[model samples]
Target: MVYIAAVVAVVITALVVGDDTRGAAGDPFGADQAIRYIVFLTVGYMLARGLAKAGSWARRDDHG
Candidate 1:
């Protein structure tokens, strides 16, 4: 589910960047910046998940 959400977010972001309905001023940071931000966010999420899983694995208690 998280992966699906990420994919959808990326696609929507791409569409918004490609859109050219803005005024003559144009985008503030532009498409390249937007893409970089999205990639960074995705990596952050993956790293968080990995850390959480590792923590859980290390704290396992076999005794009930």
Candidate 2:
């Protein structure tokens, strides 16, 4: 769900910014940027999940 939301957000952002807004090399929201976006979003999701899991683990009372 998070990944889907991230993709939607990126697409909307690129569309809103317009094609004329592309960077010097080429399309800012082109294939390469899309791949990079996916990779970053996936990594971010994993890190967030890992941190949340760690937090819950730390808060639990194992000796109880």
Candidate 3:
């Protein structure tokens, strides 16, 4: 969770500190791309956390 949050902060900071000379069409890391990256990161993190919890829960049930 901390790693994901750090990555998101870095992405946002990069977007803000990036050069502004390039046109929107020419920029590869535009606002849309950043948003997509953040969304994907969040979803992936959530899915991973859910799977981890499920695995632990199953293990606990089996042991108990």
Candidate 4:
């Protein structure tokens, strides 16, 4: 499940970055854009991890 989420996140992030670059007039590969993409992707992965952990805990509690 984590692997699937990671793959999907990477693909989506790449697509977003690519689109942003193409649509913008100035340099799309600027430092700010790169930083934003990195931040967004990292946050997304963190959220996914947190949710997965929460779900696991919930299941364990229910079983017990």
User: What C-alpha RMSD separates each model from the true structure?
Assistant: 3.7, 4.5, 3.7, 6.2
Q: List the residue pairs that clash in candidate 3.
A: none
Per-residue lDDT for 1-64 in model 4, tens only? Answer: 6655765665566556545545657644555655576678678888988998877745535764
Model with the higher lDDT, candidate 2 or 4: 2
* Location of the lowest summed lDDT over 10 successive residues in candidate 4: 15-24
> Ten residues in a row with the worst lDDT in model 1?
55-64
Q: Which of candidates 1 and 4 reaches a greater lDDT?
A: 1
Could you arrange the candidates by lDDT from highest to lowest?
2, 3, 1, 4
Q: Residue 8 in candidate 1 has what lDDT?
A: 69
RMSD of 4: 6.2
Residues 12-53, candidate 2, lDDT per residue (tens digit)? 776655478456765646656766787899899899989988
lDDT at 40 for candidate 3?
Answer: 79
Instruction: Show pairs that collide, candidate 4.
Output: none
lDDT of each: 0.71, 0.74, 0.72, 0.64
List TM-scores for all candidates, in order: 0.52, 0.57, 0.59, 0.48
- Candidate 4 error regions (>4 Å): 1-26, 58-64
For candidate 1, report its TM-score. Answer: 0.52
